[model samples]
Target: MKGFMLMFMGIGHLYEAFAGVHILQYMYGCSRDDETEQTERFGQLGYNGENFLEYDMKTLTWKSRKQQAHFMQDEWNSDISRLDFWKNYFSQTCIDCLKKQVDKGKSTLMKTVPPSVSLLQKTPFSPVTCHATGFYPRGVTVFWQKDGQDPHEDVENGETLPNDDGTFQKSTHLTVTPEEWKNNKYQCVVQVTGIKEVFIKVLTESEIQTNWEDPAPNIILIIGGVVALLLVVVGVVVGVVIWKKKSKKGFVPASTSDTDSDNSGKGVQKT
Candidate 1:
């Protein structure tokens, strides 16, 4: 079935090149009922973003969406060997492959994955967001509880969203003053389908994670760094000045004494 789909796509591309069509789209898939063991197959062809042809598996014929596509439809339907291949593939080959894939991934498809819950807040005054992510099966309930009971007011629930890893995430927001939550015992609860464990996060100042940072500490660090750098610069300058003074004091007197002795010897020669 997969091979046939690939071959059909290759043919479509070739047709697009010769027919001067900008785009050609081919969609084909199958669905099955687990209990009834019944399967249904469907296929469609699009030309330049418009429906051009459809396949009717029951009648074993192609249906033209537009009058201009009738010739192409007839041409495809007249190929007996292609029609036979489709009939056999849709009925047997596709079902067999689907069942094999399902069996190969049975553990992943049937197993339940638990979510990681977190309490997030942008600021102290903003609403507290209870985030639960990386759970499987998509059915999850997230809410806030106050003093061991569900809170009806000041709560907002968000829709479940899918992650790139095939897991799901959900969030619930609780809007309350800091004093209100601090005074009451507030908690976020996550209940995932097919799992017996209930995840809970108690609301507290320490537990609520925030992106906000205190500027006072950073400012103090900056000031300390500047003072340290200035001290280093001053120490370098002082060391250089002291070395120059020592060099001048040690060498200047000796050179002056030698010059005076040379002048006295010249005076003696003149006498």
Candidate 2:
């Protein structure tokens, strides 16, 4: 059976430069238990954070919380029109609004979605992270089991986080060495709320997604590439130095008369 609580609150504040601040707070709500079919309605008023009055549904009267507030209770209770309005609003109008809201959001409130699980490791020696994402209802359990038994040691659980799409995600980490996991059977288990099927992933080298890669295979190639690049760079620098030196040695300053144009309208040309 599904149970729900619906509440409505109204607050008003009057501020005066000399008078400071006066606040009026009204809170009314209804809650229902689906299994018992029990419903309860409540309403209260507060002033300056202190309880001022409470509504008695049976007596249809405002109960004063403070001795000083009795005058207000008397004034409000004598107003038959206001009393009638509240009686109808709480009994009918509030219930109607709650029903409409529940009906409108029934699909989202009732829906359950399963999560996609993954095993991630940042490095070979780092902890194996069990990640579950894109699940709905936000209630899920993620854990690691070793040799078909749950291990409390070296296990860390993370808080559930909400996704932008209204779904949820959670993660758990299992810290174990390669030799330990290799000898024992390790698995990641994910159980989402409202779903009966349990999701499990066996811990294996092939199953782990990691950014770490064995550099032994490419070490020689990488070193050779780096050496070749350094050689090319050095050769280029040497060539540039030689070219600059030769240019400086070959460079000659032009004389003023050689740069001057002849009277024949023919510009002086370099030979």
Candidate 3:
């Protein structure tokens, strides 16, 4: 990112020297990274990515922090951290710059339109927000949708922002449904009066899955039932065989005693 910034600064200087113009641009990360550059107009700032030196308010002066810090401590302040610090600084700056531009751009667009204009940010998924802005947009309205479909569930919402030039800015948050967004194209449509509407579509978060899984439990239950049925059949067969064997082994002595008693009594009566 530092390299990217320096490259822009160099270009800005060249443009300023040749174009005789000073472009008013922002210093996004430089202000946040080190206070020194924030105070110094050593280089021309960029708008989006490219730098037009003529637009620079500082005549596109390019200054290196290490070379310009008044005190030795300030010169090496960036070195106090590790190499990763520089890497992080650049990434953070890029992200900040990108977000700021989008947000600012959105706000600027809202103020220029008429009243009660409903600008729909179209996407393949849900919109993050619904915000619209205009000069007298008291009657102006904002609406958002996913591929012209009504939002099915929760969606992130955007707000309408008025720009400095009497224009309006509004951003719609389109949530990327992993299932749908990949194959879909989302757009933000700015519907306005006396002007061609605009469209801005941004990628959103992917849909999440909360369903449960696992088929083993049912299979295990089926196996256990089959095993229990087999055990029951085997147990009944074994019990029947044991009872039959015991009945055959018994049934003896009681018969002999009964026969002797009856005979003896009959003889005595006859004598």
Candidate number achieving the greatest TM-score relative to the actual structure: 2
Per-residue lDDT of model 1, residues 29-59, tens digit only: 6767776666678878888778899989879
> How many clashes show up per model?
0, 0, 40
lDDT of each: 0.85, 0.89, 0.45
lDDT digits (tens) for residues 131-173 of candidate 2? 9999988889999999999999999999999999999999999
Candidate 3 local lDDT, 112-218, one digit each (tens):
44433332333433333434454333223344456776464555555656677656656445454557754654433455543445533333433222233345898
Error of 1 at 148 (Å): 12
Candidate 2 regions exceeding 4 Å error are 16-19, 144-156, 183-187, 223-271
Query: What TM-score does each of the candidates earn?
Result: 0.57, 0.70, 0.23
Error of 3 at 101 (Å): 37
RMSD in Å for model 3: 20.4
Candidate 2 TM-score to native: 0.70
> Model 2: C-alpha RMSD to truth?
11.9
Please state the error at residue 10 of candidate 1 in Å.
8.4
